[model samples]
Target: MRACGLVLCVLLLGGCSTTTDPSYYWQSVSGHLRMVGAARPVDDWVADGRTSEALRAKLRQAQQLRRFAVTELGLPDNNSYTRYADLQRRAAVWNVVAAPDDELKLKQWCFLALGCVGYRGYFDEAQARAFAEQVRHAEPDVEVGVYPVPAYSTLGWTNWMGGDPLLNTFLGYPEGELARLLFHELAHQVVYVRDDTVFNESFATAVERLGGARWQATASEAARAEYARFDERRQQFRALARATRERLQTAYALATRAERLAAKQRAMADFRQRYDALKAQWNGFPGYDPWASQANNALFAAQAAYDELVPGFEALFEREGRDFTRFYDAVRALARLPKDERRAALGSR
Candidate 1:
């Protein structure tokens, strides 16, 4: 839901801010999600200003880092922060959805009521937990970060986090990676047609990862530490995201609508089973339990995002001589053509 809102925002908001209503963000999300599946009823928008002047300025700094990426790194860069708002934005354009999609309306309300403001595009806690548990069982011992909005972010009270850090607009990314992610998401905002959240996120997350790595190389030890911390969390995050996607695939395999729904329910249950098992498995590992308890469906869904779409990006990164600027340009070029043509270009590259 929040992802949808972000898509509209990023698409609507270029480099400047004309409107900054948080509810507008949420409304966009609901409408987009509903379009793909079932449009649920949402009364009022309740998103507060997660992005203030300070945050906007910070985001712009992140954006400036992107310009450096293109000019300095010679990699093709895409924008996420300045482009696509976050998970919701990507979803709006990509067309993915919740199973009981009707539940999405309730979920969206819960997001705003609870404090969700769409961090890096996705906001839904119930989903992340289910996904995280799967990762815990699968990996048994990796750091995972589940950032929900204040209305969404769970780790908001942590002293280490910055003030009013409710929504993680950059998917819990630190400075440099944040910049890259902004570019990647923006790229999606600029050219994404529809029903290609995977392509959009893959491209953005790829930029986030590869561009982040390149950007990190230029950072100080502290910045590196932040990146290390985020990376560590993302590792387990990826595991859960992978499991969630697999579950979704299993759900999608069902033929009839009833069967599909049943499959969705079963897949969610299985996701819980897998997630719990993983959490228990990782209980003994170092630095791995603080967030396990909060690994709800929303959290899992958030992480699952990365798991499903990163491969395409990895493929692209390797092909572009790891040059992100060129890679960004290449992806934009692909956007000009169709996915098939893009794939062909990638193959040739």
Candidate 2:
């Protein structure tokens, strides 16, 4: 899930006369309102005779996972994931990420409550594309990428809006994936820093991976095997991206500008070639093909944020004796520190 601006900030931006246009703010409000208006409690769906058994099962599983998150993982027990929203769309929102054309550093957007975030989200895909195009035009040297997001979190601020609902966009995901998504999103409510996108996302991802592994421990053999296959592909994808990112960093650091450009081209080509090979090995699984095709600084930076520091967070979990409550308290303590001290504490800077 991508981070979003607060509704109040958006409305304030809409009111302000800034150099940047306010259309983005208005669209965000309209889009979010639509989602909030579409939600109904899971109980309502469960009691409906029109609900399909398969969907009902998935909704029930989501509810169970939500409970597990609160009880076992110490995630916030809120209205999120307790309600259902049929968005009637493939993606809840589309996010636009951008970086300098020559570097992997993600551009940040600053807002009131969220401070600075690495990506901007839009409820409309077309609006997202339009914004991305605007960014490209504004900075011709930037590398812009538009990607769809299945879900996002409001940081429990919108619990009054019935919290975050189980949207149709991601309700059909495999069991393990659904559980991981729930765990990851709920982790945001547990501990979040204002502006540290990398730290925030990586922490959530660590929780997701840890919780997913725990959930798989008691899963049926069939489910475990299925998740194993899915995780294998995910790991392969991450390895490829990481290798390319490392190469790009080295190239940028040591090579002349022209040499760096050439190296980047070769690195991307190699990345796609390796992905093709991996896809063939997966019996033609094409889950990651789109990512490879659109490999850019923006995409690379965005993906890295989720995995960076994850190992450190996992180590912290181990240090906390794998106690969920204790681990969360440790994280919160780290969050209370200044940014530099926090990074030093995690040994990540």
* Clash count of each predicted structure: 73, 0
Off by over 4 Å in 1: 1-5, 9-67, 73-97, 100-173, 189-191, 251-267, 273-309, 340-349
What value of lDDT does candidate 2 attain over all alpha carbons?
Answer: 0.83
Per-residue CA lDDT of model 2 for 1-349, tens digit only, reads 2322222226523333222667777777788888888999999999999999998999998998888888878899889998998998888888889998779999988776567778888888898999899999999989998887888887787787788888998888888888888898888888879879888988999999999999898778987888888888888788888998999887777557888888888888888888889989999987776667777999999998898889999999999999999999999999999988888887787
Full-model lDDT for every candidate: 0.44, 0.83
Cα shift from native, residue 32, model 2 (Å): 0.8
Candidate 1, residues 168-263, lDDT tens digits: the string is 334344575455544444344333433344455556556556666767777889988876765665576456656665666566566776775676
Deviation of model 1 at 159, angstroms? 35
Name the weakest run of 10 consecutive residues (lDDT summed) in model 1.
Answer: 38-47
Question: Candidate 1, residue 349: CA error in Å?
Answer: 19
**TM-score of structure candidate 1:** 0.49
- CA RMSD per model (angstroms): 13.4, 2.3
- Candidate with top lDDT is 2
